[model samples]
Target: MSDQTLPKTPRDDDSVLAAEYVLGVLGAEERIALQARIDRDPDFARHVEAWENHLAGLNTAFDEVEPPAHLKDALERRLFTNIDSAPQAGLARIWNSVRFWRAGAFAATAALALLAIVTLREPPSPPATGETLLASLVTEQGNTRFVVLYDSSAQTLRASLVEGDTPAASDYELWFVPAASGGAPISLGLIGGEGEKAPHVPANLQGDFTDGATIAISLEPAGGSATGSPTGPVVAAAPVKKI
Candidate 1:
């Protein structure tokens, strides 16, 4: 084909063009044209130098890891044996010929037939049964307030505390006080200042602890309540339903 009949180079805005081109991110025709210019002209090398400098900072953050022993061996084997220019040229010539394209169409048809048979023979799984709701407690400041999720019918509560956000100076304690009786509050467990925990509510007290019972968080000295009632001011309080 004549030079006038060949495809024209695409135009990019000059400011970002050189950066994008040197990053090996240009479309194929732009890459060919830029590479041709770099080969023939010395002045265009300055643009490439600027791109190299721009990308140098990015390399500092990358962590280098050694390749696996098997990968290195396989790469070395392929480097010496698999990548001959002669085979590549022969394959390209065959691909451009009519017979190779006809064979490719036949292979595609065979692949489609195998896929159809496999899909038809395979059976779909039955849907999973017995669904349950996920419950969580959170504070006004976007902090998670730890509490137990109770199976009220079974009168059982599984409790835990949120880690990291709790105060280090005092231990976070869980309290279960009957809302109706104003009765002596029972201590559930000592929750940590760090993370999630699972403590079971007392089996005997579980009968009296309704979902509407008041659950309170209070600061306690190292272990928990020495007395039968909370000594500190309520830092966090909610009904059992809050979880």
Candidate 2:
């Protein structure tokens, strides 16, 4: 979905943006862009505060561990050392030494690792309210299966099946069969005969919020939709979104 199609908020916008940011779910490029914007936009700081408070709530689950005494002293010493450093005099000359090349290589590797972490963090679970929708696909034998999908800040999409009812003797798996597709339907994951569980949606299905994609529950072997497509009868089906 396009940004123009998304709802723009006048209040709590900053808080909402910051909350998502702190969750570490924002894409690497998007986070960098927000950082640049924060430098010039004091108004955006409100959002940062909102994000901080949101994360602060999660801190209650953990007990604080005190740092080692030397560790604290070392940190303070390093902080003072950086503050006491003299400004560099004029333009620094580039060194042709092997040590300089080694340092440059190390810095580049560190940057690549940081980017990998930022981009590879797990996706957020769906929020309980707002534009999110929760549904269930029931088998023909009258078993209820649960699933959820949510729109990202980028208006992209993701889905997961948490729980479902399978026949006493058969296995049930979920598939995302695109209406215009020629290849196999993407197998989301397995479901249980009862209870709740959230499975990760396919990354490839992100941003495809059109009306054509169909969510179907297919009976497979004891494992799941192993063929990467639905091999059994689609007992339950629904569109990607309400039309």
Candidate 3:
């Protein structure tokens, strides 16, 4: 597939596959498929290059130390003693005996490769700096009907309709009421019926979304409140608080 088909963010599977391909741990068939993809997909190729660049620095971190001469002799003795004792008729079985050692070595190499990849990958970005404001708009009976989150970084107001029952032929209009008494409630926007709705905060009214600002939802005629002000009864109201 082309780069446009790839996910916007690097996925975990893609990241692992890129690391494995860079480390030469993939089997013949898997390696072929990944290489083909890299040739056709620029994004995958970039990911592979990034992984290689990230892991290349680890090669100079430590000097290799040679094992003692007797250690190799002892290991060979342990590994081949059984093979040497086996019947001549079982010569074909020697390959089976060596498979475990090969597999063990491969596993160790793969593990080290994985550790290096994970250690060298870039760290996650930190969360946005400003405090997020939250509000739980509730009915007069004190039952929460909607949850609102104001993200100052994105300058958006997100409202989630927690209580599912939205009146047919009517719209839910959201309003922002400043903390100062006597300030008129400002029209924010209309929220969807059953799911979450994120509306961009008006650039002119961004300053109205401060702590202690109240959010209220009103049921209005279909299409929204007509007079630019809430014309229906306020169904739910809650004060904004920093979260």
Q: Say which candidate scores most in lDDT.
A: 3
Which residue pairs in candidate 2 collide?
14-47, 162-197
What's each prediction's clash count?
A: 2, 2, 0
Tens-digit lDDT track for model 2 on 181-233? 58567766655322222234556675553433555666676666556676666
Assess each prediction's global lDDT (C-alpha) against the native. Answer: 0.51, 0.51, 0.64
Q: If the candidates were sorted by their lDDT against the true structure, best first, what order would they fall in?
A: 3, 1, 2
Tell me how far the alpha carbon of residue 105 in candidate 2 is from the true structure, in angstroms, after superposition. Answer: 56
Cα lDDT of model 3 by residue, 1-243, tens digit: 475754555576688789999989979999999999999999889889999998999889779899899999886444322121211231111121333333423433444456547746858547667757766654544332565678887776766556444555667788876677887777777765223322446788788677666667777786777797878777666666665
Scored by lDDT, model 1 comes in at 0.51
> Please, what are the lDDT tens digits per residue for candidate 1 over residues 148-172?
4556455434545532244434455
